[model samples]
Target: MEEEPCSLVYRLEQKYLNDDDAYMDQDIVLTNFTGSSPCKMASKRALELVVLNNANISHLGDVSQVSGLMQHVAEADLAWNSIRWECVKSVLKHLPQLRTLNLSYNPLDGEIAVDLPSAPLLHTLILNGTNLSLTSLSSILKNTPCLQELHLSDNKLDFSDDDESVMNESVKTIHMNRCRIEDWAQVVRLMRRFPNRKTVFLCENPIKSIVHQTPVEDLSTLQSLNLGKVELIFQEFSQKKLIQIYNIIDFLDRSFNDTTLEAQVNH
Candidate 1:
C-alpha cells in the first residue's frame, strides 16, 4: 500500500466531501501550467464548468483520466493553445455534454476533419484562425449534425464548383469573413438551399455582384447578411434582379430585429 501524493489526496478528499466544495461545485478552472502532471491531476476531479484558458497543453494525455468527467462538463474553452486536430479529437471524445467549444487561435493547419464517436451536444464551435478547407468543413458538417453556430472566419475556405452541396439546412450561422470567396452564384445557391439559416457572414469576399433573379420563398428565416466590402459587379441588369436584392435585404432586416426567429430553432 503506497500513499498517494499530497495534492492528489487532498483533491480526492475535497472532491468527495467538502463544504462549498472546490471540485464538486467548481464552475471554472484555468491554469497556464503545461506537461502531463497538471493535466492528469485536473482530469481526476469532476467539474461541471471548466476553462483551461491560455494553457500550454498540446497533446492528449491518458484518455482514461478524462472519461466520466465529460458528462458533468457544460462549457470548455481551450483557446490560444498549440493543439492540433488529433489532440482536439481526443479531447472531444470525453466531452459528451459539452455545449460550447472555443478552439480559436490554435496552431492547427491542413484539412480539419474529425469524426466524433458520439453526437456532441455542442451548439457553438469556434474555429477562428485555423487553416480549414472545404473537405474539412464537409467532414465536420457530415459528422456533427447537432452543431448550430460555426465560426470559420479568417481562414482559407476557397470553395470550388463541386463544394456547393456542403452548405445544407442544418447549420444556422456561418462566419466566412476575409476568406476571399469570389463566387456570388455559389453564395446564392447556398442561401436558396438553407432558407432557414439565421446568419451568413460573407464580408471582405470579392463578390462582384449578387444577381438575385430567383424569387425567395422563405426570407423570414434569414437573420443577418454580411456582404460588406463585397464588390457587387453587375454586367447585365434587369428590373427583376433589383427587386430581388431589395426584397432579400428587407427580409434580412426584419429577421435581424425580430426575436421570434431566434426562438424558432433550439440548437
Candidate 2:
C-alpha cells in the first residue's frame, strides 16, 4: 500500500500561508500521522489557522511537542494513541484557549493526577479506556471545576458506598460502561450525588448485585441504563431474578421520564 501523506503540516502551511481567505474558513483539521517527524511538524504549526483557524487536530504523536500547538487550538482530539499524564500536563500548560479534549483509548496506566495549568475554560473531557483508579479520577476532577461532560468507561474504577465523595455533580454526563463495578450501594450513592446529571452509560456491568443489595425504588435518577450483556455473563441468575432486575430498571426509567416531563412543563 502507498504510504499515507507524511507532510500534512507542511502541506497545510504551504496551502494557506499566504491565503488569508482559506485560513479564515477552516475550523477543524485532522491529520493521521504517527511517529516523530510528522508529530514535530504538526505540533509546530497547530496554532497557525490559514483561514479563520478554529483548529482541531487528531491522531498525531509527539506528546512532548504538543504544548507548542496549545497556543492556537480551540479543541483537540488526541484519542486512540499512547499519551500519558505527563504529556497531558505539558500540553495543558500552554492550551489556554482549549475548550474540549478527547484522550480516549490511550493506554494510560498508573494514577491520573493532572493539575490543569490553564484549562479553566475547558468544558468536555473524554478518558474512556484509560486505566485510572477512583482516587486518581477524583484528583483530576478536583482541578477541572468547569468540566461539563466526562467519559470514564472501560477502566478499573473502585465502587464502594464509603467513597461517595469521588463523583462530582458539576459533571453533566458520565459513561462508565463495562467497568466491572458490582457495588449497588456505591451506584446509589453516585446517583444521589448527581441526581440532575443528564445521562450515565452503565452497560455490561454487574447489575444483579444491585438487584440483590438495594431496593428497586432507590435508583430514581437513572434515565438510560444499559444491561444488555449482564444476563449473558451471569447465567446463574434465574429467570425470575432477571425479571425482577428488569422491573427495577423499568421503574427507574419511568422516574426519569417523569422528571423530564416536569422540566418540560415548567419550561
Candidate 3:
C-alpha cells in the first residue's frame, strides 16, 4: 500500500486573525495542506483552528486523518473542495469542541442515507455554494441540536412552496443570499420554520417586490432583515409597520453618504 504523505503544516496569517483574547492562547492554524495526513500536527496541544480550503480532498477517507489533529479545534474551514456530506460527517466525528465549520463551495449534495453524527457544541455551519437541498438540511439539523446560524448562499433554494422541515429553536440567523428566492410568502414560511430566528440575509435574491403586505406574524423575534443591496430594519410602533429604505450611491464614493428612499409602505 502506498503511504499517504503528511500534508498538514502549521500556519498563521496575522491578516486573518481578529483581536480576540480567546485566539491569544496557543492558536495554531494549518492551512493549504495537501494529501490526507492531518495528523502531523497531533503533538500540538493548542491546535484550535484548521483551514483546509481547496486542498484537493475528494474522498471521505481524506478527512478521517483530521480526527487526531482536530480533537481540540473549535473552528474549521474546508471550503472549495470536492468533498461530500460523508466527508463532513467523518470530520465532525472527532471535533467535540467545534463551534464553527465552513464547508462552502463543495459538492455536498444532500445524501441523507444516514444521519450525521451529533455535534452538540457546533453553533455555526456555513454551507454556502454547496447546493444543499432542504431535505438534506433538515437531516443535518436533527443532529446539530445547538446550531444557531446557518449560511446557505449561492444555492438553489427557492422556497416558493410548502416544504416539510425539522423545527429547530436554536437557529437564530439564516443567510440565503443569491438563492433565487422570489416569493415573499415562501420566505415568510421559511422564516416561521425557525421559530427563534432573529436575523435573515436575503441579499441578491430575486425577490423584486414584497407580494405579501402583512407583516410576518411569526417572526416577532426577528430584528434585522437584509434585502437586495440595502438593509431593512424592523421597528415596532403603536401600529406595527415594515419599513424598507433604499440608498443609491456611486461605487467610487469613499464617503458613502448618498441616500434615497425608493419606496415605502405603511401597514
Specify the highest-TM-score model's number. Answer: 3
Candidate 2 per-residue C-alpha lDDT over 65-106 given as tens digits, one digit per residue, 9 for 90 to 100: 344444666676666655667667755765677678877776
Off by over 4 Å in 1: 1-45, 112-114, 166-168, 192-195, 204-206, 213-220, 228-267
Model 3 spans > 4 angstroms off:
1-42, 60-67, 158-161, 164-166, 213-216, 230-267
* Cand. 1 TM to true fold: 0.63
**Model 1 lDDT tens row, 1-267:** 843222222332344334343444443442332454333435555555555544555765654544554556667677776677777776677677777888887777666555545445778888887776666656655656678887887876555546456454567988777766666666666555455577888776665455545555544566667666543432233656555655655654554455221111111
> What local distance difference test score does each model get?
0.59, 0.57, 0.64
Listing every candidate in turn, what is its Cα RMSD in Å to the true structure after a full C-alpha superposition? 10.0, 9.2, 10.8
Q: For model 2, which pairs clash?
A: 22-51, 23-50, 23-51, 23-52, 24-51, 24-52, 25-52
Candidate 3 lDDT score at position 265:
26
Local accuracy of candidate 3 as per-residue lDDT tens digits, 15-118:
12324444333334554444433333333333578676666565444434344555677898878876777666766776788999998998877666765799
TM-scores, each model vs. reference: 0.63, 0.64, 0.69
